[model samples]
Each structure stands twice: as C-alpha cells, then as structure tokens.
Target chain A: MDTYYKPEHLSHFASIAEGNKALAEKFFSYYGAVFADGALSVREKALIALAVAHTVQCPYCIDAYSQECLKNGSDLEQMTEALHVAVAIRGGASLVHGVQMLEHVKKSSM
Target chain B: MGDVPLLPTWGPDVAGPGLPAASPRAVRSLRSRGSELASAETQIETVSRVDLSAMPYAGSFERALRENGWARLEPAPIEIFQINLGKLCNMSCRHCHVDAGPDRSDEVMDPATVEACLAAIDRCGAHTVDLTGGAPELNPSFRTLVDALVSRGKHVIDRCNLTILLTASHRDLPEWFAKRGVELVCSLPHNRRRNTDIQRGDGTFEKSITALRLLNAAGYGKGDPGRRLTLVTNPAGAFLPANQAAMEREWKESLEREHGVTFDRLLALNNMPISRYLEWLEETGNLKRYMELLVTSFNAGTIAGLMCRNTISVSWDGRIFDCDFNQMLELPAVASDGSGFHVWDFDPAVLAARPVVVGRHCFGCTAGAGSSCGGAIES
Candidate 1:
C-alpha cells in the first residue's frame, strides 16, 4: 500500500485471468509455448526473455526472468552481457534518431 | 609411486589459510566455531522451526511422500558403498553440505576404520566403492584404501574436489587414478569463473580448469568407459539446477570452446539444505523460501530412483547412514532391534530390510529433477 509496486503482486499475476478466463488462458498458453525448448534452448529463451524484459522496462518480467535465467543455468556474467545487448539497442535506437535533428538544423539554417 | 608424497602437508598453504580474502562467505567449519547448529539435533530443530503455514504441502517431507503414495520408502538391493574418508578439506566452500574444512582434520578415518570398511565392502556384495570426504585425497590412507578396493575388483569412484588434484601431495592423483582405471567424479560448480568462484573460493575455477586439463592429458573424459570423467555441478545460489542433459551439452560446448577442456559427462545436482549450506540459507534469510521451493517443486516420479534406496553411506568413523546428508546430520541407520549400525556390523540383507530415514532435508533430493550423489535421478 505504501508503494505503487508490491513485490507480491508478481505472484498474484494469474488472478488477472479471473475476469476473462479464455483470453488469459490463451495468452498464457502462448507464453508457455514460446518459452519451451526448441532450436533455441530453454536457457537461451530465458536469456532472450531477460534481454527483452529490460528493453521493454517491465519490472514483473525482469523479476520473473532473472530467476528464470538463473534456474536455466545462465550465470551473472551471461545475464549482464544480455542486459548490455538491451542497453546497446536502446541507446542505438535513440542515437540513430539524432540524424532527424541534424537534418532539421541543416534545412532551417541560413 | 616412489616419487609420490606419502603424507599430506597440512600446511597453511594447503589448508585453512588458502581461502582467498575476497570471499566474505568463506569461514571455518561450524564445529570449530562452536556453533549449536554443529549438533545434528540442533540442525533438525532449525529445519523444523521454519513456519510453513502459507506454503504448499505445509513443507512436511514425510507428508509429501505419504500423499504421493510412498507410505514406507524402502531400499533396493545395495549396489554402491560410499565411504566418507574424512572432513579435512583444503577449501571452505560457501555451499558445502558437509561443513568440511581444514579445521576438521581431527575427524579423518583411522587405519583401523579403513580396514573395517574394506572388510565390509568385501562382504556387502556392492560392486562400486565410492570414496568421498572434505577432500578424500587428504586422508593419509586414501591410496591404501583405493588399492584395497581395486584389488577386490570393485569399481572405485573418487568423489574429488578438483582443486585437491592440484595440491603438492595429491598432484599425481590423475595418473594414479588413470593407472587403476578409477572413475573421477569431480565437482566444478560452473564452467564460468565468476559463478564457480562465488560458490567455491576465488581462483577455484582456474584451478578446476587446470585439473580438468590434467585429467584430459591423463586420458579422462575421452569417451573411454574405464577412465570416465564426470563433472558435477550445483547452482551457486538457492535455486535448483537446470536440466541435466541440456546443461551437459552446453558445458561440453563452453568448456571445450573457451578453455579447450573436455569432459565425458556432466551431472547436475541440487544443493541440500543442511550443514554449511543451511547456515548460509539462514544467514541470507532464504531458509523458508528455499524449503518452500523444494517442497512445492517435489516430483513424485523421482521417489523410485532415489539414491538412498540403493546407496549406503559410511562415515569417517565407520558409522552407516541411508545417505551422505543423513550421515552429516549424524542420523545412523538402525538395526531391527533399534541399535545403531556401523560398517563393522554391515550385513547387506539386514540393510536391505530397513526403511530409509526421512527428514525435511530429504526434500532437497526430491525437488524438481531430483538430485542424488550420482546426479539427477530422473531425466
């Protein structure tokens, strides 16, 4: 109650399905299928999910996937490297947009 | 054999002071610290004291078994005789369930007990003789015992912490074991240095790699049945190990690619909630959560393949237990008349009739993929 985000809220995530069971079940089913091992290992998927979690800035996904990554045999070094991938992409995304400012300045200048 | 060191040095460089100062969690054994938890009774009380009202299955390992239709967990025919040579380890690992360290040198098995163990191994009809300890190689009679077991034509397994193989006295172990065709089941927490060093001491992963390369040079991990080299891994934290087969594939690739090291197989194990690990769980405030996780993740299918069902653990002093964890807690296997059993009194038929002891810590073996000394019980 004191804060906007309660740590316990992560465990209560399934409760969101109570209002729309079918839709929630479908989404969860897709989520489970997505994480299951395939050509990319479960460990790899967990690391990818971890990187995407950071890119999207989802605290719940970050918390869940951090444990997921560790449980799947990814160490802190690998996790940190995965996080840097997110950082580079996010930074690169912003830096690429600098060309817009550059173009506008050149066009507007005398 | 003439050039090999017959006696362990027990020097500061070889024992207690070898731990790197960077590791804050590394400490002397609980026995040396005079901790109440050093007593098995206190450890049992500590495990039971945790509140589990909100947790699934109420965190009772026995009830979890009963609910899963295992009313009385009984043993299969004995196949492996695991001997705990002593508790005098060179390193004080943070997650060690044995509480073994240099301070525990007083607990090593004497020559008389080693002779008794050999006599028991002869009578017990078990095909495999597993030697374990703080570092089994540190025991003075380790080679003598191994030579005896090998002469009996029993499969010998040295449960080695790889760092011991690099020590001054024990450096020739790889070649010695190779000549005898003894299987080396070494502990390497992770292929990566950071995770491996975090659980063990700093510089451990490098030492482990060097040891593995020595093992490779001596014809281990090269797909030979006799000279099999198996690396065991446990998670560095409170979580369970990942899938064993998958982890083995990844380890094979990484250790080979990164270090050019090779191993025949990998056995992923779960950290048990007892001894030094129990101390860490309590210190880190993860005891309740970890116990809950173990109970909730319990897999009923693993019950039939439980190592205690086929393994008899003999302590350094020749006391017998259903498993190594129980041995650490001082829970001796009892005879039908409720008398404590020892290696001197080992009777395979009598042992096969006894029910395996159950405790809250037993959940460590049953959780998720289910862990045993040999590795994952199922899958």
Candidate 2:
C-alpha cells in the first residue's frame, strides 16, 4: 500500500528519464508529434486521447485529456460518447474470448 | 377555471412615484424600494457584489488571450445597441440571471431613459437595437421605442419570455411584433415539460406552448423572411449547453410531434454563473467545479467574435456596461483612464476605442462553443 505513486509524481515524471536523456528526448518528441493537428483535428485527437485514457485507466491521462476534450470545444455529451466507445471495446474484448470457451466445451462434451 | 387568467398580471404604471422620471444624466441609479441604496459613485456601488479579486481558478483569462496572439483585446465598429428596459417580470424563475421578479417594480426604466436610448441610437448609427428586460414587453414605453426604431429603419429584436405573451395585457403582442417586423427571440429552456417547469414555474410550459402557437398563426416561424421567430434555450442546471445544431434538431422534432409547435432556429446558451444561478451553484456545492469547468474549457477562438466587441449595452438607468452580465455585477464600463461613462455620452468613435471591462465571470462566455446574447458564438 505504501509506494511511490504520489499524485505529485506525475509532475515529476520527466525527471525519471533524466539519467537517460537521449531516449527520453526522442520519446517526448514523438509524443508531441503524435498529438499535433493533422488530417484529424486537435479536437479529434483530444477525443481519441480521452477514449484511450479510459481504456488504459490512467488517472493523470484521464484528468489531462478530459480538460483537453473541453478546451478543444467538446461538450459533456460528446465526452460521454467517447468514454462509452472505450467501454464497449473493453467489454467486447472480454466477450470475444468466450469463443475459446465455447469451442472447448463443444469438443469435450462430444 | 376556464375563465380565469393563466397568471396574475399588472401593467406598467409609468406615472408612479417610485421610478424617477428625470433625464438619464440626472438619474444615476434606479434604487430598488426596500433594498440596499446605491451611492452616486458607480464604482463603489456594490463593493461586496461578487468580488473577482480572489477567484479560485488557477489561470488568468487575460494571459490566455495574450498567449493566443491577442496583444490587446479591443472593440470593432458597434453594430448592435442592446438596451435593458428593466427587471420587471411576472414569474420569479429559479435561474434568472437578472434576478427579475414581480417584486422588482421599482427597477423598471422610466420614459425619460427610453427617450435617451432612442437618441443614443441615432447618434451611434448602430444597425440593430436589441430590447431586453425581465420581459421587455412589460415596459409601458415598449411599443413607443419599437415604433420609433422601426420608422428609423433599424432592425429590432424583442427578447421575450414566451409565457409573457399569454398574460392578459400582452395577448396582442404577437400580432403587434409581427406587424412591425420585430424579430422575436423567445426563451424556452427545454422541449419537455418537466425541465421547463422546474427551471421556470408550474404551468409555464403550457403557457409557452400556447404563445408559440399564436406566433405560428401570425406567420412567424413559417419560413417567412419578414416574420422571424428564434427560440433561445439555456441549460437547466450546471453544465455547458449541448451543441446548437444538434439541440435544434431534437427541439424541432419533439415540439412538432408533441405540441405541433415550430420555430425558425434554436439558440443554445451557457448559463452565466451570476445572480440567482450563482446562488444555485453555491447551494448545490457546484460553484468550485463550475468555475473550474469554465476556466479549463476556455476557447481562444471565441475572442474575435465576443459580442462585447460589436455591441453597446445600455442599462435601465442609462448607465452603460459591456454586456448585461456586467450590468448585473455592477461593473460599469471604464475608459482606459478608469472613469465611467453614461449612455448620453455615447460616441461611436470613443466607444470603438475604449477597452472592454472584464472579470472572472467572463469565463461563462468563453467556455465551449462560446456564449453571448445571440447564443453560441462559433456555431
């Protein structure tokens, strides 16, 4: 229960890779590029990031991307819809594994 | 029950002693009866009224505008001159930004101030004159102002709370407004009855539906260019309004199928956290969350189209403000040197050069799609 997972740790995350500057620099540069506006708008990217934040269940990402969604002109209704998309996919992933159960049950019962 | 009026009503008694009939410049403040008296100095009028000095929000709105390339926010040529007739209303709604009610009789604008407004309009040369109040139609000089503006070839907008038309005295308002080519921007909070009644009062939905039908019968909202009827909706609770286009579709379908009522367009507005609405947010323990929501949801694109840039807001007592929200907060329009100005001194050149007076409550206008007197800005 006692760990280094302080809420303030998120702010100090970049410090973790200070000992490995070259790799950390490359990773941050790539992240900055990935979220930039391109074919998909900044709004679209924010919504996508919100959905992924829900799927991964990162508290920091969820907090940051929720504000991101609103800052980019998305409403509560649109944000709720994006979260539901992540929920459906996560639920579907679990349900698809039931195919293995069905195949095993049918073969063994026979 | 059949013969009874839907709501108790009273016409404006302009000859009454409570409202001063002096010229606009002489009437500094229209002090409400049995309420706190305001001093002549406009700046210190309401010292404790919603101070923005220690706002809990983490960011500064001015810094945000600057970072977004707005070195100095300034006004463009004034196109709309909005006049707040007064705060007299039949119904005491729960979420009124004006805090308007039947008890606010003394706050009504006198005929002298109305005349001053017309003179200011001629001087400003603004294309549109927007008349709003607790219910602007309640003003005794409402028709006189409208007729004068129409004769002068100025576009007029009457911000009507639909139920006002169902009252006994205002029954002929629909036909009169339609005849003068006055665009009716009626307020109906929701399509369903529960939300509308909860935010307004019991039977408000029924009366509003009746008023909408009457407008429809008068050729308004029937796709006529001359007779335009637009519905304005604000969220019932502490949240930014849904998208205007999406809500418009839903409102059209539900109103048509259920009540057979129709309107030309739906304007969704975000409820500014001020007056009665701010009290509600504080009571529900949502004031902090709501402030955070507005600050975090700020959109830089809304700056260019902010209504304060294109509109001149004149208060009931002839004091000028940047917007109606500022009027309620007692934040008078200030020059760069920080002196206040009155409506009688309205100069287009001076108005265009003056910087807008803003405070933390401005977050209400910049949040999401952005809100203004004309509903959402971006959409």
Candidate 2's residue-wise lDDT over B52-169, tens digit each? 4444344466766777887677888889999999888887776777878776778888999999899989988899999998888888999999999999999999999998898899
Candidate 2 residue-wise lDDT at B188: 90
Q: Score the docking of each candidate (DockQ).
A: 0.75, 0.04
DockQ of 2: 0.04
Candidate number of the best TM-score: 1
Q: Is the docking of candidate 2 incorrect, acceptable, medium or high quality?
A: incorrect
Candidate whose lDDT is highest: 1
Score candidate 1 by DockQ. Answer: 0.75
Residue B291 alpha-carbon offset, candidate 2, angstroms: 0.8
Per-structure clash totals for the candidates: 0, 0
Docking verdict class for candidate 1: medium
Stretches off by above 4 angstroms in model 1 are A1-3, B1-25
**Model 1 lDDT tens row, B76-186:** 988999999999999999888899999888999999999999888878889999999989999999999899888989999999999998889888889999999999999
lDDT for model 2, please: 0.79
